[model samples]
Target: MTSLYDADGQALACTVIQAGPCVVTQLRTEEKDGYKAVQLAYGEKKEKNTTKPMLGHFKAAGTTPKRKVVEFKYFAREFELGKTLTIGDVFAEGDFVDVVGKVKGRGFQGVVKRHGFGGVGGQTHGQHNRARHPGSIGACSFPSRVFKGLRMAGRMGGNRVTIQNLRVLKIIPEQNLLVISGSVPGAKESFVIIEK
Candidate 1:
């Protein structure tokens, strides 16, 4: 999707994705499996990338190579085994969906960079090396142990994030595209799961 904003200067068209014609590999029911679910396989990968167990699984389904497989819980009752469920089947324009994906990894960041902590001494009395430092970490003999979740410097990002209730602006079934009205997590071409 384009990164350009709308007429009102809000983010516009940030999540235009070419979604699925994913194959239904497995069907789960409440009686036998103790829950309801439908497993979907999408994105064909090379034979080399597939493992022996995965290849056997695909072979049992009488289908081709797939890169990603995921399960959807509490699915509708109308689904069946070996059904080729496409993006056109579930989603439509004006429908609300949730996009779940992993965020970009930024390893080993500082407190000001990672946790949005205001650092010490943009201007201070006789401060030399205190810029961007997490100052005053403790009280004087009152609470000597630093409090938990105090926004210290650490690893950042690369976490699973879900953007909820994003409106589907358009659906191009021919192109397998889903144009959503807001931002989704992860980078371009990364695997993301969209659910109603």
Candidate 2:
């Protein structure tokens, strides 16, 4: 992520995304696949690590093995096999787009971090070890059981998240990079899907 300045001298926080050079690997039709979608492949991969069937798949597309292949439903127009798509092909400056990616995994987090809990008590004389613990979760006799869907300390993050309506700050066609206002999902170098 970086910062850009406008003519007014205000700094705009932005996220630079390495968009594409994506190859049109496959096509899905309503008659054959019972759906209409275009599958685009991006990022090169080693052939030795790729599976045999996937090797033939990339061979048919006349491209090398790609690490990421995403099927986009409802493309604006039809694209032929082996066609390459760059950042300039779809997006323009000042366009609003949505970015989808996974969030960073926080394995086995506590309630304080996971659910924004403020802890049980203060750091005064009587609050030694129970400050960070989850306060009473249930009644003693009425139901005598913890209710379902209660927010507790557990697995957190590592979920798919979409940042909506992000304004496009700039488009670097030469380098196939997209600059958008504000932060995006996932950790650095993670894959994200940009949609119009």
Candidate 3:
């Protein structure tokens, strides 16, 4: 969960992602659903997470019950209803994977912490007020324009991110665990996708 190791075994920092033995709840085809994809369901929560429409979705698939449905675009294979997917089939140990998840939200923050700006050069330079301020909105008299897409501080994190090509270390099929070599986003037990 913290570091990565190559095949020869050297430590590197990366993220770990645990894929699933997801259930094939829905199958989409180009002719019918206008796309080729498979809808997979993972995790099982209490009835609160299962709505009436979702209950019908599970019932139609004949699955034992689950939350968290995600669709994959592996258009080559055809998945039928109620088919159970396993980690061993989709990925193996030593395979490279991409981990996608929403990062933790760090509410509102200032420019110093958010954007990595070096504040105010030095305290003795009579620059106390500009210290953490974004500084310089526009030109004085030239074009006189504040360009868009500037780096300023506001809300941070809680966004979807995809970390690519993380090597898989251990695949424990018995415990349904994946000891990937590196760090994954979100806290422990947070849902994430591991894709090839």
* lDDT of each candidate versus the true structure: 0.84, 0.94, 0.78
Candidate 2, run of 10 with poorest lDDT:
131-140
Better of 1 and 3 by lDDT: 1
Residues 103-178 of candidate 3: C-alpha lDDT, one tens digit per residue = 9989998888999987656667666667777776666677777567777889999999988887777787865667
Show pairs that collide, candidate 3: 14-182, 14-183, 15-182, 15-183, 15-184, 16-183, 16-184
Best candidate (score: TM-score): 2
RMSD of each: 2.6, 1.1, 2.4
Candidate 3 yields a Cα-based lDDT of 0.78
Model 2, residue 166: C-alpha shift (Å): 0.6
Using all chains and alpha carbons, the TM-scores for the candidates as numbered come to 0.89, 0.96, 0.87
- Candidate 3 regions with alpha-carbon error over 4 angstroms: 2-9, 12-16, 139-145
Q: Report the error of model 1 at residue 73, Å.
A: 1.4
lDDT of 1: 0.84
The residue-by-residue lDDT of candidate 2 on 1-196, one tens digit each, is 9999988999999999999989999999999999999999999899999999999999999999999999999998989998999888889999999999999998998899899889987889788888878898976898888889898999999999999999999999999999999999999999999999
Highest lDDT: give the candidate number: 2
Residue-level lDDT of model 1, residues 134-161, one tens digit each, is: 8877756877677787778899999999
- Residue-pair clashes, model 1: 0
